[model samples]
Target chain A: MRWSLLGTAVVLLVVFLMSQRQQIEVSYGQSPSSPDAVVEGEAGELSEATVPSVEAMTAMIDAEPVVRLPGSIARWNERVVREAIGDSDIRILVAPPGLDEAERGRVREVERATITIVGTKVSGGVYEATADAIPEWRAQFASGDVTTLLVPMIRHLQERESPAVDASFRWREPTAAELDTVTAELRANGSHVAEGATLEGVPEASEKAFPDAEALYVALPRQPFGQPVPRYGPALARTFPDRPIVVVYGSWIEYDGPGAADFAELVSAMFYAQFGTRLATYDYPQGNVLNAWLNRVTDVRYAGLFDRPLPYLPFDPVKVTMPALPWLFAACVAGFLALSARSLRRPQAARDSRHYSRLAGLTALAIEVSGLSGERSDPPLTRGIGKLRAATEALESGLPPAQVRTLLDDAENELDDTARLLGRRDYRPRNYLEGRLG
Target chain B: MSASWSVWLVGGVLLAAAGVGSTLVPRLRARGVRRRVAWSTARAAIDSAAVSRDACATRVAEAERLLARAESIAADRGGVLAAEEAARCAERADRLWRAARRG
Candidate 1:
């Protein structure tokens, strides 16, 4: 029974190891950040190394491309770059999401070559600000009626020319009604907007706007100047499954970017905004556009948070799942090895030959004694004697210890019956024997 | 796939194979050895018991039957112990026949 359990445990360990092996292969075998990796999306390949023509990008516009917006030019990983210019022909013109008015001027001055066309296109499915769109963009900037969105790209030319810029955007308080409308729009677009959800990192002034904390509580902390974008904690996301989370960078106040209401409005506005509208609508958790919208947006660039792809953040799978798989597989293999060693060390057989030999001796004596008595004359006794002899012969043959003992016991019973029969026949008194002799 | 990935996959498969080989092969070998030993013992005993079968016609006929059974057991698989027992029974039968003749 114990061996069976051990065998079962080994089998289970092997199964566990196999399961983890697949995950490990996926984790190490194919890196998600490889720029040359061609992922077959519903549209054409999502990871085109060379820039594609304008017509090609336009053809994929209706395919609902999923873009990865890097927090800044410096923070751009291959994954971010691969998603951005995978389909577009134009060169990337990058900047930090949140920038002050002075930094904006510096950015504009640094790139005088394309100053009129400041807003470059994102890769895959973003709006290509063509020669026709460039005039309108300049006109809008001059008019001051709308805040034009900046192009989402890596490698800012301004960073090469001027000193490093910090993330310090303008701040504004939003009304509670606007937050409600934003939440409603998110819900319509298949987002799980937890109403009255306790939002961490909200300023005290905006805390009253969200009074009740009935649902998932998300912490939208400010992203420091050059650090990577903030992602929702895996622990927090696991706690409230299916709750929508925003991977916030800086879409709020000047220091804080936008208020909680403003942040929500920006996220909801991205669903309809020209560049963000092409984002493939994902159900609930997978489709949360808050990260994608906030990673590109900053206060200096996107004064109107709703209209610009430049104002949004980027979100991706948390770092936890990919790294832990290799360790788990290793542990499972170790356990399997331990169990197998234990199983091997145990003895296989414990049958003793001397035990059967002893039983045979006892059985041989019983047969001899039974034959010595005159009980063989009786029909039943004769048959019993024959059976005892046969049993003795069976014992001499190399039966297993248990079966030999059982046969010996049966032979002993027959011998006892033969002895009893002899006792009864020999029960004559001494006096009666003397009288018969006289 | 990366060259390291092939290394890992091959390494894992080899590890699993080694684990199975290390634990299972020795036990299977021991069992085979035990069975062969039992068969050898049974065959020797059966040969020894066959000599006395022609001494007494009635008693020796029973010994012959037991020896036949033992031979059959030894010939087939996994019945070595039983064959040895049957041969021992034939030896006992020979002893009983000699005792009956002396009585």
Candidate 2:
């Protein structure tokens, strides 16, 4: 039974490990790839590197159409567009001023499309260039919901898109700590971020500031020091409801620590396109899988980020849970000894062995002899032994074993030698050589 | 049909091996290759076989060293992909050696 239990446990362990390997996901869109890109050159704005860049938002806007441009636009432009909000999985549609009823009336058209809104941080610049580029605000707290299904958009849908936000380099100092704080909080919660020694050869100050970033994740932002901002496609397919999708410039984000060699694996997990990374929607059950993957990376790569270590999964073989063998052996030996001592006794001469048995009723013979008149009975018994011995030897060897019995008076003996010996009978009675030969 | 008994019996043997301190991970990895070279090389000596005293001592020693080195490498720089792989390989080697030693 013990064997069966242990066997089952071992088999189960093997199967479990084989089936549940770890999964890792790399988050895209965080920092700019290089510092050089921040400085615009004669060619125009300095191009961002391949790292995913997040656009900033100044204020929220309602999903209402107010055409600022007077030029006649195409039918597609006039049609309602459904666009992604922030990182949320929410979608919003902006209808024309008087077309609210018409939009509701055209069920088929409404089914086909809705107005799209890009919930993003507007950079400071274009407002000063022209009134068309002036910033607008709305009281409605409009945003996207980044569900398993929908993705967020950080910018406008385009034919002729709006220009950049207006702000002078001298006066503009927009540095929101919210994005950094939220990311750090998640890493802390998941055990992915760790504190470690500073490394050399990093090209930016962030290298020292967040020196203890996940190795695989930190290395991503380090690649492509200077170039056009690499593409970060939309994270959602639709304007997801209430989810905040962060759109950073082109930069690599590490799931594991920088030392992780499987960054290629992270890249493989997502779909890449001109826009950005998209974590596509799957079946309802798959959200758990995604979360599980996140948990795995958090654990599997969580080693270096902290001083005190995390406890491992319950992978060690249960400490041979059965009672110990040595204890059992000790108990058995003790019991055996107890029984042996209790049963110890002298050996019985006339019992299992035929030689020992049938050696006359020695006690009965002695009693009968004592009852006999004035007889010590020793001599008679001795005589009986001689006769028995002589017969037995004669039968065994076809010759008389006792020379005295042959030379002297021979007894017609029916008794056996074994009985005579036990009774101590004298074979010779009062003869000159009495009892010598017997 | 219930050869569960065999597992227990084997477990006993394995326990004895562990108690006797013969497990080595590297040798286990090297097993079943090159004429099952690990087992052959690990045998302590023909003379020792007579009493069955650490018949695989030599291979066990070498395998242990390899496993330890691998473990050290893995402990540091574990975040990198290459480092992580090496660490896993080292862990495997150690486990294998331990199995062989136990066997």
Candidate 3:
């Protein structure tokens, strides 16, 4: 928890510092105030020269160089990069829904910034080297929207939520009452109007006012018959050819290895998704996060007093400027949390109190069950106690409870007494002797 | 026609794969660590896992060889301690040989 908190603090600090590009640039010997600092030719000193380390000849031969056998022994002495990185995971970009103005700018900024950062982190993001050079690299995809989407997509990866219409305003179409009200209000200023939903479309009608050229067609689609998959994509495409159609669909998010077989399978699977009428598909791949979110969804409920949008403040989703620092800070925070969780999960001899509690319960159970017949006039009390004790011992030794019970039963008949004791009065002593003799 | 083609193609490929896997399975098994003598750890560790009747004929022969050597050494003026040591060693060896052979 402390590690996660520290990680969060570090991420916030990164975000805060990154917000001010001035200080962040200084780390890489660049001054944000002077753009010329980035120029390779301009500098106080020419450049840093590579330095060579000198080692003693005797130390080289005498030293028992430890070689690491991967997945087995650790070699602190041997410091060499592994020749191959195991199992490269295929990265899927799932863009967050409906980017606010501020977020969109941040997206663009990150896209530009990734060109520099991607140069260092994973040289060639499997997409291309020099993020700017990715254009010349792709055969058909050149608009660079894919690269633009990757940054925020990777940073703010969330499971797909139900696609919803953001806002809807409704009015009874061509209502006589509504039209009368509109005309009464408009005619007071000496204006006339049609009795329809067109009263609200007054602002948009001046551009398409010719009655003979175009007819007002207000039609709603009938319910689909067979497949429930929304046919709205092609429907809208036919209705409005010039305007672009955006279709959204829910998808399972999971990680897939980058093997050609898996890649081909995914490609083939996507071909069938066309019948589902999805305009464009984006892989969300939040298996790790979705499980956690699902758990939260099941267990937790929110009652925040006000909206605390992560990237935005004050007036919501408006003419806002995007800041790059916050997103970077969030990334650092997430990384820190992940690392802390992974690191701290290491096992110790620390036992859970619940485990000890369970043991104590079973011990008490044994004490109660051991001498069950002791208080009564049960003759086979010692045998019963012995059996119970044996079962308890088996339990203590970690045998299955059922097996212990069975074993206890197996020893039961051998311990039962048929004859009565001497303490029992009422002419039972003679009878007890006879029984014993028999 | 398409369905049948797909079925036949997948079937042939799977059959070929199965044949190839069977051929390589033995080699892969052999590459692993060898088993111990007390119990079967992987595959064959001892000459024979199964023991016949009271004791193995081969185990008796080996035990006899060791006993014969100890006898010859004792013949050339052996001390009480050496004789006792020899007796203990023979007993342990014989016990192990018998147990292994029987097991």
The lDDT ranking, best first, is 1, 3, 2
Q: Give me the runs in candidate 3 sitting further than 4 Å from their true place.
A: A1-389, A395-404, A417-438, B1-103
Model 2 lDDT tens row, B26-102: 33432323222211111111111211122223365544555555445444533334343443444355445435635
DockQ of all predictions against the true structure, Cα-based: 0.08, 0.01, 0.01
What's each prediction's clash count? Answer: 33, 101, 1
- State the weakest 10-residue window (summed lDDT) of model 1 chain A: A277-286
Question: Model 1, A85: alpha-carbon shift in Å?
Answer: 42
Error in Å for residue A40 of model 1:
38
State the RMSD for candidate 1. 20.0
lDDT of 2 by residue, A1-438 (tens): 433433444554344345345346432322222222211132121122111111100111123222111111111111112332323223233221111222223311322122321121111112111011111110000111111111212233222343333221011122345334434543443221222211122223333223344211211121121122222212110222222122221121222233334432333233122112111101111122223333333332343333424434455343343223333333333343343334343222222222112222322333343343222233333444333343333333322223223312222221222234334354212321233323
Which segments of model 1 are wrong by more than 4 Å? A1-131, A136-332, A335-339, A342-438, B1-41, B54-66, B76-103
lDDT of 3 by residue, A1-438 (tens): 634544555554544445445333322221112111222223211112111111221232124221111111101101111111112222221123222334323323322222211101111132322212211111001111222223322332222332211111111233456445533543353222233211222222212211122212211111121213222333433443433222221221111121223232343233223211111111112221122222221121111112322322347331232243344444444454465446445234244344334334333433433444232223233333344455555545444345354534422331322112223332132342245345
Fnat of all models, as shown: 0.06, 0.00, 0.00
* Candidate 3 per-residue lDDT over residues B1-103, each given as its tens digit: 3553343344445434544554565445333211111111101101111111123444555555555544454455354444544445444444555465446
Q: In candidate 1, how many Å is residue A192 off? A: 42
The per-residue C-alpha lDDT of model 1 at residue A125 equals 23
lDDT of 1 by residue, A1-438 (tens): 434543554564455456554533321122112122222243221222222233433343323332212322222234433543345433333333323334334434432122212212222122332212322222221121111222232223222222222222222333456445544543454233234322333222222222233222233333232233323324334433444333322222111212444464443443234332122111112122232233333321334434533323345343344344444444555565566667667464455665455444544444444455552423224433344454445445444455445544544444455556566422212222234334
Candidate 1 chain B: 10-residue stretch with minimal lDDT: B47-56
